[model samples]
Target: MKVIQVMFDTLKRNALNAYEASDIQTPNFDRLQQKTVQFNQFFAGSLPCMPARRDMQTGRYNFLHRGWGPMEPFDDSMPELLKQNGIYTHLVTDHKHYWRDGGATYHPRYSSYELIRGQEGDSWKAKVDKDMNIDGLDNIPDEFKQRKIGSIAQDLYNREHMPKEEDHMLYRTVEAGMEFLRENKDADNWFLQIECFDPHEPFFVPEKYLNMYGVSQEEFNGWLMYSHDDYTSEKADQLKNFYKALVTMCDAYLGKVLDFMDEHNMWEDTMLIVNTDHGLLLGEHDWWGKNIMPVYNEIANIPFFIWYPDLGIQNESRNQLAQNIDVPATILEFFDIEIPEFMKGKSLRKVVESPGEVNHEAILFGYFGSNMNVADQEYIYMRAPMPGKEDYLYEYTLSPMRMNRRFTPEELQGAELDNSFAFTKGVSTLKMQTSDFMGKNYQRFGNKLFNYKEDPAQKSPLTDAEKEFEMIEKLKRLMEENEAPETLYTYYGLDQIHSVEDVRKEHEVLDREQEAVTEEITFVNYHVKDGYLTLINALKDKTKAQAMKQHVQETKAAVTEDDIRNWIKDNVDKEEQARLFYQLDMTLRVD
Candidate 1:
């Protein structure tokens, strides 16, 4: 038995014709629709990029304990499990995050892997002109102008290195996967993951695909890569068109794989899975990007398709809710390997074998320290953190690394060694205190209750108190089932009675005492210390310094250019700025 999984990044579910009406035509996805079972209610468990990937690889949600970090020592990675069970696993990906600190532990789990770089700000090419100026780029905010210019310039530099369309990172990644299949077609009991970071950002594609989308070459605007932006409707439409063209490019590449399967008659033996980590927000809910806003239908609800040729399951649609966590469990079950006790996800193969079989009553998902969201096939509830209670969050992880760097000394200053969880393999881990740098964006959007049957757009928050309570109960139950920390219940203002029993009991008396003493205890007035301010000023990276400056300015604090200049000179050399910027950019993307 063999399996081929093609995972596309930032693929909007509605972009495919089989999924919804879209200006972009994804015929290859439509073709796959006929050959596989499409999961309509499939949602994202963890958020953004690497967190979602973590959920896929480990079959467990990581957002509850950690924000964004590498695979823990105790993680049960399906590929590693398969490799141990005498099954060959190969991974080919253009997703550069795998090289970062948070994602570094993932790709190494495979028996063999290949990486193709130059997706977005990869620093792949050496001769990029950072000072390249873009003239007449109107309505670009001053803060975003430099970033926009850097992205365009780096893309221009990278494009110069790729003389042919086939040399593009996505093309190379897919080609590598196809090459592997061509070389090892006769081999049995192997799993191949062909993941591409295309249709993600930069929206870079050959002019031919743009033509297919009826978008002229001159009108080709690069992907709006901002994490948050307010755009004019015209500019938003242009960005959407560019995204459509890139999606068309993805379709063409997918068609190539379909052709390969047809030529080889591989469908008779190999199982094929095509899915995305999560969808992108293209001007949905008046938002231009993800992570900065609530994970609505446009982002949390993702596209999931799987084909098991050996089981004769094809051309079907399953409404039972599933998520990214199920992928690993499905793969493990397909190979007859026992699912790890640590995995909270159910095997998707059971659904394939028995259609419409419900595996979960509700699924929990969100960014760490952000909203704790839950969906029960009827309503989506985003539970807000209690007011003035954001500081209760702690990141429990065996790996102290963030996206591209180690946790700062200050971050780990009050770290505690904890092994309370059953899944931690009885090994204590550093429970680092999560601060503003970890994820200060929590509670920004507030809580929302969206009824899928009535308000699919989630335009208005539902006010049914009973229904909300029911969803909250579901959320509490699922969190406990996943071994959520006791602090999480306190964060939500929920009673500790129904939480993880041992942890709840440990904290119950303390919680009552703390509540009683809250009025008597004098709280220190929070203010930005001079040392912390100096640290922000000492950010040698231009982007990070700008980010800190923007954040400080938003706080209405007085900071000047001279102060920034003096700090830059004192911290790090100018040559190291770009490297630090890349790392900080990756780290802050999660934050």
Candidate 2:
């Protein structure tokens, strides 16, 4: 038995010809529709890049407990499980994230893997081009410069080496995948994952592809930015064309896989699962990218196709509520391996065979710390944190690394041991508080409800009381099933806001107290014994400092503001210490 999973980073569903893509030329996808079971409503369980990949690898949702991070030590990785069952799992391609700090734990799960570099902000293939202005932040987008201010100058540096279409990462990644297939055509008992980080950002493709869509080579920049400061109707149209051209390029390479399958007659036995990590926004719903925005269909409803020889369900589309996590369970079941009890995903065998049977009433999906979204057949509910309730947020993880690096001392300072989640295999995890520190968007958009039947575009939010209640209940039930941390219930206001009256009261309280409620958070080192004197000297009221020093001396304790901060650190919980010291320091400045 064999399975080949072609995973793309941000392949939009609506950009595929099979998924009612009108303007985009995705004939390869259309051909795939004839050879595979096209999933019409497949959604992404976790969001962005690494979180979605974690869901695919672990067969469970990662966003519920943690944001972007490495795979947990206890994660039942799909490829590793397959290998344990006498199945050889091999990974190939240029998804540069697999080598990142957060996604580093995933590629190793496979029996053998090949990593091709130079995608997105991947620091690969350095070449000092004296002709190009490499040092300035002028070329970099503001999202890469300010709020998420950084430089993607590496991408341009990497591009300097790839001068031709064939030299591009996309081309090389697909070619490597095809080479793997060529080598393993006669071999069995192997699962191959060809992951490509293309059709994602910059929409960087060959000029030939752009020419097909009447776009010039110079017209495309990153095309997708997190900010809407430059969005216009004309810009949207231009960006859409660029995106379509890249998707077409993706289709061109995808056809190669189809051609290989057809040439070797591998479709008779081999299973092919073509899926994306998640979809890109492509200026839909007046948004440019996926971050800090609502997880609308453009970003959550991804492209998924499967062709299992035994199922014989080709050339048909299913309305099943499949998600990224389901890919692992489907592959396991195909090889007759038992799906782990820890996995929340169900096999798609029944989804394709059982018509008119709904597999999920509502599936939860979102970026962690952003929105907790629930989508059923009819509507989607995006629940944000209540005004004051957004103050508390945490990420429970065995792996303390963020998307690109290890957690700093400040982030790890307040971490506590938590042993509540059932999926953690009785192992305790570090409970780290975010506490308004992370640059990632949390509760940027308010609560929203969209009925698909009325607003397919999700432009207008609905105001149905009954529907909102039902969706909220379903979200709560799903969250409970997922064994979400108890703090999340409070942070999301699920434990508090039940009715309109509850909402009204919270809003009133928020309105009155929000003006005066400014909380400061930080960590203090007790080794700074002079902190006591520093605090005392900085105080406006010398008499009060003197009185406090005398009291501290009598009690055999420290007297400075820093000393008090350290004292709070040694006595009170770290969570409360920061706030207490902040208040004390604020008071010390008073005359």
Candidate 3:
């Protein structure tokens, strides 16, 4: 069987006319919808670029264990499995992340692959345009100037070389894919993945597409300018139009693929799957981009369509709730290969053949160290870490490479072998603390529950206590099924269903365990000694001691001179409260 999977990056569900009404035209997507089974409730299992791709390949979620990392050594990659089954797997993509430190392991799994450069911040060009000045570009903070300027400069160089619309990276990528299809159309036992990085960021499309939308050259910038500053409505509209123009260009590429299939009549034999990694946030919910905000429907719910030739299903819409994880399992089923026991995804063949079939109860998705979210088609629940509990998370992976750099010495200092999950194939691997790499807001969105039926935009957070409790319990059960780490449960303050520590001990590094215990004791002893020092320091500062006494009697305001003054005036018996206040002052300082 031959299959072609068209993976588009950051393609929103509402971009096509078949999905939702928009000023942007996607006639090709609409045309493909007629010949394919469109999925109505497809969500992204993991987030951003690489993590989502990992889920697509492994048929399991990646965010639960790691964020933005490469394929693990133990990953049951779909392409590799297909190769082992005597099927040729080829990949064509402009997603440059595949060449980075963390993504280097994925493309090698394929039988053959082609990477098209000059997408986003990809450093494909060296010439720095010293004279080009974009409007409002200087408003970017100085701290971000180097990276942003480098991207802008590289993009300027890339655009300079492409004089024609056909010379664009998206067009070239599609052309390469078409060439591959034309050459291998009659070949047996081959799968082709035509991955496009268009319509992602920097939404740079050809002038012809911009002309179709009546967007002038000067009005369009080749940068998305993912700034934290609030955007005016007019500016947001302009940015949206730019993205729409790029989508139109991407639609034309899809049309070219359809044209190839029609001309060759390949539809009778080839299975075609069209889907996006995840949706992009275009100023929705005040989010300028993805990864740093809540995984709302605008960003999490994605577009997915499939055409199975043997099944002979066409122009139908399926509402069976699916995710990116299902793609790998579906591919494995198409090739008649045995799905691995570690896979957590269900094959979409069942759901496609029978739309009424329920494939999943709840879909879990999130970025690492962010809110852990679950959705049941009607309601979406986001469980955030308790305040200051974000540190209680760890990343267990054999591969310690980061996005663009190797793990630092500090990051690996406490790393040790661990086999806390059943899917690890009885192999102990490096378990590193997430706090070593994940900084504050590592893509954080606080706890929230939303009923999409009422608030499709997810603007209003629901306060139903009973509903929240039910969702929390469901999330905990799912996490347990996924074999999530103990720290994950502790981080969210969820009741542990099983002892993850026992699982760790089953494959323990005895020396590391003892060292961990020793470190805990040392930490406690240091704190005790620090408390005495703080008390001595408090005794030496009578002004501070008096202020602390006054602070205890005042209204509950954080430490401030005004609050202390108010307490001093209100207290008539200062001597009686002095000792208690001194201890309180020492405790506050020590903590």
Candidate 4:
């Protein structure tokens, strides 16, 4: 039997809901859903695209690598295993990150792979221009350039004027998949992975789909405004409508692929699985995009579906907590292959045969970058580090009333003490004021407990009680069993350096040089006029002053006296004393 996995990027479960609620229809997906076993409780192992894709391909927890960028050289991914097993693996995607040199290692593991470029708005521009029969001109107006950039406005204009022809990436990807399916109908067993890069950022949909939802240009632009603060109730509704339209557009394409599969009778033998890497937040919790906050269910709880024509587990829904890590093991098990010992996920085939029999108690999630949200099922925890500092832990109940509302220090201190939260016991560190010493925020070992059954939305923290001890103990055991050793290969510093001695020598040289360099001195003078302290750069250059003003505007903070002094110290080698004086003058004006 052939296995075809069609993965859509950022396809939210709510998108399906919205399509059903509105006049916009997805006949293909709807029919496929009827024949497939829908998994309602599938969650993402990691987030923001790449990490989740790694989890799906590696069959391991993302935290094992500390949420680092791209795939490491030591990563034992599934595509390699599939290739070794003679399962002709292929990947067709437009995810820009996968094209990065450091990130392309995973792509090579596949027997065959294709990358479709043109992110932002340019993806549709070439096709639109070609369809419109536009001449090759040396220059174009800003308005025309903006349209070519794939802006929402330009897409609307295309629907009215050009209407996408046969040149869209979406159309190309679908056609390629359909053609492959037809050619491989009776060939050797294979695995085809098709990734669609749509319904992501810079939301744009054809007018055909927009018309189904009755969305207008005013409503679409108004929805864009809701991405930030100053949102209104009316604006929120319009944004919701616009987002719904985009989902419908995606669904329309999904239908096309499904119809092709059905026409070729591919579903009879193919193990068809439809799922997304992650989700998007459209005005949920006052946020419009993915990375601004934690992995709420709106984004984390993804849509997972599998269809096996010969299997009896059709038209069923399971709520057992499953994640992307299980995907590799599931595929392997389907082919009667043994799962590797290092794999972190169990085969879902058993659970599918005996629904409600599996006991998956808790799932762990972690975020590594600027936005961090770690949680189980009951309570959500956050750690937002100050610029150039270690993160401080903040606990919160997941209810809308408590989200983003700071907990008083007294309240945190007064909570009943218990061993519900895990604490990292093995670690020693010399604290540094600046995060530069550690390179990034140091990981703190801690434990968190949640009552998922009672509060699936994670609205409240578990209270300390004798009855909850078992649950806490089980969670700790799971965490310990799943934890993987961190090797030097995974560390950001070690990964960059050629050898251990190189890393040590680089640091040692810097440490020795630090003692001989003398600190530089500078001053800023502020004048009070009309009850306002106006600061001016003593070394005056109108252009430099304007540049500094622009910098302040962009960073949303004035260049303070300390900032200027640091700038001078860092760049003194380039301009000597002149750099110090100019920076000092700029500092006074910023203050």
Candidate 5:
């Protein structure tokens, strides 16, 4: 028997809906829908990519540990468990975060792994540009160039906005898997995990797919509106279309792998599971990306499908509140192995045995930076930290660093009625910053109650009733018990023991050197060459050019230009030559 898991990164539910409405047909997913058991109400365990992956791989709630960092040695990851059981586990993915020194531990735990790099957004755009022969074109419209160049530029800057090259990674992975199957087909049972980094962000589909959306680039941006207004309405719409296109593209690639399975007769004994790490936020709650806001259904809810011919469950949809953590337990159950006692998720075998029946009461969701929530099928309760007086005062003065530095009453006057929300303002009075509080003890801030059945979007806040208060208390207890380590506080200087002397000593050197330097040179070198191409494209649009110039000026000011230039010169050991080349490169590229 063999188990195959296909995981897509940041595949949003709305993106799937858009693909269904588009010209392209996702027959592969449709087939899976017909033959496999699908879970309509599946949710992510934790989010912001790596953290969620950690939960899925380890079968443990990440809330019990610190968010997004190295996995502890004690973590009993599923891949390692599978390997111990004589199951050859393989991982194929293109997520660069997993390759980082601190992040790569999880990959090597598997028997065999492949890290497919250079297939991110810019890399995919470069592939598209190279394939389409757009590099030499001088007559391209500024908007089109902006779209093309912006896609690459955004990809270079942000990993989330990178391209959906999961299909490419999948193809290569399937090829490798097929080879492994040919060799190990007659031998031991194996477990293969094919993870795709796709449908994430900076959504850039091939032009051919863009044509299928029946919308211009300008019209497409409207669908991509995030919480921050990072993309204009026009840009958002295009991104939505691109996201849909990538989903369909991924479906097409999945179809190829399924075909290979059929041709090799591998489907007969194999248990295939197709799912995603987490969902993406496509304009839900006025947000575009995943991390900034609360985990709405759009991002938390995911599609889970399992196909096992021997299980006798086929073509069924279950409205079970299954978390990704269940996958490890389910696999263990399938092999007749005992599920670990510490595992929080239950096996899906019961649901598979009774197709339509499920018992899902409540599930927990959390944000590493801010809050935690406990949502049942009916209601959602969110608990977030309230900003104290010092926090409020700092917001008005824009002083994030100097927490102990007090502002005068005049400086704190207008701050009372600043941009804070009504609920936040009300609770702010009861709270105190960690800095102001002498002890490490803290209180839960404000708790939000919502009837999700009536308000799925959570637009209307439910009043704090007796039941709501009880629920909030219960959730608060759970949160305190399941709290991740206080890593953020320690790293951000909030947990430091700073004396007045310590503060003065830290700033004294800087104060003394403030006027010591003059006539400095600064140079900013971008690692990606295409970043320069993007600057060139931005210059063609007068508005964008001005914004670019202002951005450069601000950036230069933020990190002393002279200091940067001198560092570069000293590092390169060719002062005049490096300076001349750097300036000439920027000038030639920026028009």
Candidate 6:
């Protein structure tokens, strides 16, 4: 029972030929289509990157509980469970987020892991260049508002170390994955994951893959802003070419992976999975990137293909609605492991083998503190928050952090221990406040019901009275089933009484005695780094920079201009430090 899971980041559904985008070339995906069961209605869970990965690993949604953070102490990671059950799991990935503060707890679940660095602002390489001016670059984090088309400072610095096509991280990622399979392909009862961060923003492909989509190399901008733009249609087409070329590169690497499987003659007994976290909008819906817009068909609907050895279904497409959260259950069931009762996802082995078997009646997908979307076989409903609500979202997690760095002390100042979730292992987690609010953006794009069966493009908003009521009921039912926060029920104005029992009454774990920890040990490595990031961003303001530098010097901690992310990983990755900064941090700036 060998399983090889191949994951990609920001892979647009239309970029692959199997998903019926005639323009982009994906011969390897087309090849996989013949050897696997293509799921036409597969959707994404959570969002962006780490949230989706958490959902895939835990077989449950995380967006309702937390925004973005590491796997909790109570999380039931599939790979960890598999490893405990005598199955070996290995991870080889170039997704740089796995090493970040929010994603720090993921890769260790595998028996062993390998990471290929220098992808999308990873703090990998270090050097000082006199002429390395970043004023011309538009993709820096500080310039995200008007970010146009340029690589960030860190990515450019990392690129200096990679002058050849084979030097790229994606190439190295694939090569290392093959190296693993080369050593252990014959071994059974092992799971190998080969994940790549490609075709995402900063679409910096090797020169070989560019200019193949009829857009010349000179016209290719390797970056796209994460906001809506009025770029000329000509520039949009050029950007599309850039993305297509990157996808083609991904396809090429995928073909190499498939070639490895073919050359080894392992398909007869091995299971192959092709999946993505979620799709991105490439010049569609007047948007260029993701995370800030509605989770439309272009983004929520993802491309997934699975090849099961015993039940080999080839060149066939299934319309049953499934989401990425089901991957954990599918893999667990394949290994004959018991799916945890708390796992809400269904095992797709049955769904794939039998056409009449329904995977789910409805599934919810979106980010935390935003519009909650519901998609069934018939309709797609983007449920809006209340019109005048301030969102007032709280992230429930054992570790409080964001995608990259730790949350500020102010954000965690109001945290309270909560035990409302069913899968938290009876551990009360920190219920912290966040600044993610919903108003104009979330509500405006929502309340939109698209009859996907009649209007696949989602251009026309359907106004069916009966279907709207049905979907509203469906949303409430699914939300309650998922153990949604009480605020979420109010956000959608679905706070009607139902048969669901009171949570505190049903689960009285809170009344139990708290575990006591009284040991006190001297900590050696407790130095806090200075506010160098504040210093760097305030360079133009000499007065502010001087004040920040003085404050930093007063703190007497290690300071460096080397890497902000490295500094964060070293300084802010701890909960106590994040909370300490509330009192220690300077209020010299708007902060």
Please say which candidate is ahead in lDDT: 5 or 6: 6
Q: Model 4, 1-591: lDDT tens per residue?
A: 678888877787866842234444655567767778888777777665766776787776654334334554445567777788878888877665566532555688889887765443333333434343222211232333335333444444433433363554565666677677777878867888877777665455555666676766544532142122334787666666666666666677778767776788777788888888888776665556664444567777789888765675677787777778889888887766677766777777766777766635656554433333333434433322222233322221211111113334544443332222111122221111111111221221112234545755544544443323343344335546665222212321222335435544644654454322211211132311100111122223556445543433354343355554453455334334343342233222221
Q: Which tens-of-lDDT digit does each residue in 322-423 have in candidate 6?
A: 999999999999999999988888889887899889989999999876678889998998766654454556678888767778988888897899999888
lDDT of 5 by residue, 203-259 (tens): 445445556675543343222323323455776666666776777767877786688
Q: Candidate 3: where is the Cα deviation over 4 Å? A: 128-144, 436-445, 496-591
Q: For model 4, which pairs clash?
A: 121-149, 421-447, 422-446, 422-447, 424-445, 537-585
Give candidate 2's root-mean-square deviation (CA, Å). Answer: 11.5
Model 6 / residue 414 / CA error / Å: 1.7
Error of 5 at 149 (Å): 12
User: Would you estimate the TM-scores of all the predictions?
Assistant: 0.82, 0.82, 0.82, 0.63, 0.63, 0.81
Q: Which of 5 and 6 is ahead in TM-score?
A: 6
Q: Name the runs in model 5 displaced over 4 angstroms.
A: 17-24, 121-170, 177-186, 214-226, 355-360, 389-446, 473-591
- lDDT by residue for model 2 (1-591), tens: 999998778898888768764888988888988998888888999887889888988888998888889999989998999999999988887877788788899989989988887777567865554233333233233333432222355666677688798998889988988988999899989898988888888667788888888887576555365432355787677778888888888889989999999999999889999999888766566556775567888888888888878877889888878788888998999999999889998888888776676778789999888789999988999987654565467788888887788889888997899999889999999998775432223432557889875788887888666677788788989999998888888888889768756655655665454223211212143223223433443444567556545545554332345546545455454444443443343233211
lDDT per prediction?
0.77, 0.75, 0.77, 0.54, 0.56, 0.75
lDDT of 1: 0.77
Q: What does candidate 1 score on TM?
A: 0.82
Per-residue lDDT tens digits for candidate 1, residues 1-591, read: 999999899998899998898767888999999999999999999987999998999999989998888998999999999999999999999998899887899999999999998887666788824557665343343554576677677766777687678888878999999999899998899999999998888777777777776665466447564543336677777788888888888888899888998999999988899999888877666566776556788888889999887788888899898999999999998899999999989988778879758988899888888788999888999876654576788889878888767888888898999987998889998887687432433443445788985887778787665676677789888999999998888876666334344333434554564344232322222112222233443354668655644544454335443333344445556555443332222223221
Model 4, TM vs. native: 0.63
Worst 10 residues of 3 by lDDT: 582-591
Which prediction has more favorable lDDT, 1 or 5? Answer: 1
